[model samples]
Target chain A: MAWTAPMIDEVTCGMEVNMYFPAED
Target chain B: MTGAAPAAEAPPIDGSARPFLPRGVRLKFCEVRKSWFLLAPERALKLDQTGVAVLQAVDGERDFDAITAHLAAAFNAPHDRIAADAGRFLAALIARRMVETA
Candidate 1:
C-alpha cells in the first residue's frame, strides 16, 4: 500500500461545564 | 503565589529515541467525524488516516528507526521519506505533550 505522510491539526473549541454545589451556612 | 510555567522538554528525534503516548493521552476514533484523533486533557488533535497508522505503530519499545522501518514496509514507501515525515510528526506531538520519548 502506498502511504502518505501523517498530519495532525489541533482542534480548538469552546467548552462549558455546569456544576451544582450545596449552600454553605 | 504564581510561578512561571515549566518549559516543555525537547524530545529526541534522532532515530534512536523511542516514542510513546503519555498518560492521559489517547488515540481514538470518532464515530461522528469518522476520523481519528489524539485526545489529551483539554485538547484534541484531528488526524488523517496516515496519522492513525503512524501512531498505531508507536509501542514505546520501537525506536524512531524501527518505527520508520515498520511504516515503510507496511506502506511500501521509501524509508528515508517515512523517516523524515514521521520524525517531524512525532517531534510535534512531543512538543505538545501528547507524546513522550523514552
Candidate 2:
C-alpha cells in the first residue's frame, strides 16, 4: 500500500506493547 | 545494529519540488547508543550513517536534483549513480511518510 498519513497511523497502532508474565509454578 | 529500511519504492519523482522532512518528524543521534534514529510521535527507527545523511540533506528547499548533487559531491560519486540511489532512498522515505514534497 502507498504510504500516507493514515498508513502511519495504522503502523503505529499495530505497534503493540508486550508485558512479560512469569509462569505459574 | 539494525539497519535502515530497504530502498524499495520506485516512484516517478518530480525534480523541481522540494523533498523535506515533515516538522513533526525528528532525526536524532543517540550518544549513549552511538547510533542515529528517526523518531515520530509514536515510532522510533534505527538509522545508519547514510540514512542520517539523507535526512540531513532535506532542508525544505532543495529539490531532488540538488540533493542528489550534494550526496554525489560528498561521496565523490557520479551524478547518475547518486541520482538513482538517492531517488530510491527518498522514495522509500516518502512512502513511510518521513519525507514530504513541498
Candidate 3:
C-alpha cells in the first residue's frame, strides 16, 4: 500500500447546483 | 545574468541496493476499496496491480535482484524483463523522492 486513503465525504455551503437537459436540434 | 542552477541529485538505486518509501511519503492499503495508495504532502497516487506488486517487494531488506526474482516467480514472467522494468520503475520513484535507497 503506497497510495493514500480514499476520500469519504465532502461538505460545502452556499453553493449553487445547476441541471441541464439535452435539447433536440 | 544568473548562472543556471545545478541539477538536483538523483537518489541512488541499483540492483544491489534496497529501496523503501521515505518519511514524507505514506503508503496504505484501503480495506474497503481493496486498493493501495501512496500519499505525499501535495498529492495522492493510485497504484495499479503491477505497481502494487513491485512496491510490496520493496521492504528495505531485499535488493533489486531479489525483488525482481520474487516478482518473476509470482507472475511467471521472464526474469530479465521483470528486472529491467522493476529497476526502471524503482529508479523513477527514487528520482521523485517517493522511494529511497536503504
Report the Cα interface RMSD of each model, rounded to 1 decimal. 9.9, 11.8, 15.5
Range of the 10 consecutive residues with the lowest summed lDDT in candidate 3 chain B? B1-10
Best by TM-score: 1
Which structure is stronger by DockQ: 1 or 3?
1
Q: In model 1, which runs have C-alpha deviations exceeding 4 angstroms?
A: A16-25, B1-12
Ranking of candidates on TM-score, top first: 1, 2, 3
- The digit string of per-residue lDDT tens for model 3 on B1-102 reads 122222233443467887888876766665655767555545445566677788888888998889888988888888877776666666666666778887
lDDT tens per residue, model 2, B1-102 = 133246775685787879887866777665756767666556565565656676688888889888878877776777777677677777877887877898
Stretches of model 3 off by over 4 angstroms after superposition: A1-25, B1-13, B31-34
How far is B74's C-alpha from truth in model 1 (Å)?
0.4
Of candidates 3 and 2, the better by DockQ: 2
Residue B80 displacement (Å), model 2: 1.1
Candidate 1 residue-wise lDDT at B33? 70
For candidate 1, lDDT tens digit of each residue in B1-102?
Answer: 112122223443888889999987888777767878787766777788777888999988999899999999999899998987777778778888898988
| Model 3 lDDT per residue over A1-25, tens place | 2222112111111121001111112
**TM-scores of the candidates in the order shown:** 0.80, 0.73, 0.65
- Docking class of predicted structure 2: incorrect
User: lDDT of each prediction vs. the true structure?
Assistant: 0.74, 0.63, 0.60
